[model samples]
Target: MFKGKFRIVAVICFVLFGVMAYLSSQMSFGPRDKILPGIYVLNVKLSRMDRDQAIQAMKKMEASFKQARTIQYRELSWSLPMDQVGLRLNYEEEVERAMSFGRTGSLWQQFLERREAHRSVHLKPEIHLDANLLEKTVTAAAETIILPPRDAGLIINDNDTVEISPGREGRLVDINHLQQELIKSLLTDSRSPIPLKLVVAPPVRSTEEVSAMGINRLLAMYSTQFDPNKVNRAYNVSVAAAALDGLTVAPREVMSFNEVVGPRSTEAGYKTAPIIVNNELVDGLGGGVCQVSTTLYNAVLLANLEVVERTNHSMPITYVPIGRDATVVFDAIDFKFRNNTDYWLYIQSHVKGGTLVIKIFGNEQFKKDVVIRSWIEETYNPDTLVENDYSIRMGDRLIKQKGAQGYRVSAERVVMEKGQVVKVEKLPTSVYKARNQIISQGMAPPGDILSNPELPADDSPVNGEMEEAEER
Candidate 1:
């Protein structure tokens, strides 16, 4: 009888424990759309909330974190929005994560999760930060705060005096450290304003360090003029010229136009302008850049440097004299010259008013007077071609198309020392193809000749300029 009584009490205890376990899981399984009770992320309670409600709850925390988040350096401060630096919390993932707690696992594990939820489960949201975006933001801020160092320069006085300009030190931000600090400030609830870690950046070299590394005197200078009214083309010309400023080449080194200027696209800050293609000028990117190269080529020739490679346009360009202009295309065609002298060759270029000028400098010992001479070796006028038109009279003519004159031009570099031509080097011969003039003759009568040999060949009039020329 005592044994029977013990068995009954054991059965009652088992039923009580089963009821308690079910009660725990029942708390977790209260509603399909709701999160279990007692869940929080960063002190923001998320219990009994749906996915949307939980996301809305997390945004409150985001707003508090983003309030007045500023990074200050000196007198400048950048108010960083979450999107600027690509710092954001994946609210959808966080809500899903919060909802997954008691709803996951088997019944036993669910009960355990529910029990743990009563004790309060706290978590941090998944942070998404793009390193590149962060760096760009910091760099933009640094650009505003930092003062760039100036390098020493030279000025040629009117009385033939060489003046050396002074150089100055600059201050720059500690980028890596600043990035770390930014990340730390973002991850924690630090209310202090972010401070920049700036470093003193000295000049690349002292002005007095080496005044003459074979660059004591100006070797040659060439200038080309452009119409400032052509806004896009002028901008491209200026950009290309600026790229060549302060360019230095050691002895035996070669300078390439395409390499220095790089790719000319909208991304590289070039606008569409007139470009020559198949001897016809059309709207294209980096149109006026060739003018920069042409000017540089003339300067290089006047400097008596060795020309490694150069190519002239299919047709004669109006900016430079025939056989003097150099045409360059990225990757496919390039303008290159070698620094044949023992001293360093330095190139300086700038655009002023409406002119682009390029100057070459090197040792005074290598300086020689160079005069460029060019002439037309052969001229080929466009031949007139007539097409009989039955709709018009025999002697009457209608101009269908205009034509261009072709030429074979030659250029020579006359190097002079002490007023005597020491060397005369001929440049590559340039040839332009003649475009045939088309004319329509009236052949209204059956009596009109099928092939008019005695066709009158006088042009009507030279009216407006070609549309292509105006673009240039």
Candidate 2:
């Protein structure tokens, strides 16, 4: 009787095991159009949904993830827009992942996991980020916080001298390593600020190198003064002087004054001041900048450099001698010179104590004794012009404008080397026109009213104009 009972129990157990195996195999190899239960991705429920339905769900969630991310370096932060960084979800990859849930494991394992009241299984979505976009974003962030390495430079000191400025090492974000970190962070699906790593880069030119460039000794120096009381004129002078300061000119290089200083509009920090217009003093922009060019021209002359192109004012300016002044216009007229020496030339300029000073520094080749002289060859006397004015009393005399005398002058530069005159150069002759003086005398009879007389057309020359002027 006991043997008979054991045989019956064994037969029942075999039958139940076969049934379980068949059920597991059917679930594993059967058509799987929907996701298994207890699966979560991006905190969205995707269970019991077809592949297309799951894809639609992921698309909706992706829109919410497109938000600005913050990147931090020390205490500074930069907001990186997600759209610009090319952040998106791979719908096909994610759907394939969810669809393969019950089909991956062994038959027995799938049976156990797919059973009711089983432990929850979490899934990772296939998120895609553009590699180039990642690099560009990090680079932009680095640019904001990184101070670029600057080469050593020169500065104009208060005491009318040149000084060398030290270069500084700069820091930049390690792009390759940062990219790995960014990818890992995106995998985490966390919305926290990412920290940045930096590396040091050396400067292109060091301070010691700049100082040893044979620009130590002063070659030639010249200075001219403007009225400090005239604030606009003083400002204009300072602007031009600063633009030319600490400039380096290579050997045989030609530099134009207008090209170096640029246009002198109000946008360039020039103000209206008394400038010679039509051979008469009038308020105009960039009035006192010519004084700076004149000073530089004299310094270049003393240094024995070659004058490439130069023009003189229509009327002689009081700041410099008749033939020593150099005038410049933005696009029409220009003053240019070449660095004829073998060594490079360094220009230093400054405005202090109502004086604009320009100094040229170079090697020993430029150090020489030099003298500049100008002699008046011809002088033209001004003519007297009388006009009747109804505003003044009868027989009353008033000088409308003080006359300016014009002249032609010749200039020469003498250079001495080793106690002997080595070179003599004659500059171009300058010719100026005479401006007639105007005396307003009341010529109307008493109690006699006259119609308003039309004023004569103004013949004043425009600033930065040499149309009617000539240099021979």
Each prediction's TM-score versus the true structure: 0.64, 0.64
Q: Candidate 1 at residue 18, lDDT?
A: 87
Report the C-alpha lDDT of model 1 over 129-158, residue by residue, as the tens digit. Answer: 677776576766557777767777666554
True lDDT of residue 20, candidate 1: 62
State in Å the error of residue 321, model 2.
2.7
Q: What residue runs in model 1 are displaced by over 4 Å at the alpha carbon? A: 1-24, 28-33, 69-87, 102-116, 126-216, 224-292, 313-321, 327-334, 338-356, 362-366, 375-384, 389-392, 397-407, 414-424, 434-440, 445-472
What would the per-residue lDDT of candidate 2 be over residues 72-110, giving only the tens digit for each residue? 898898887767767788888888877776566775565
lDDT of 1 at 189: 70
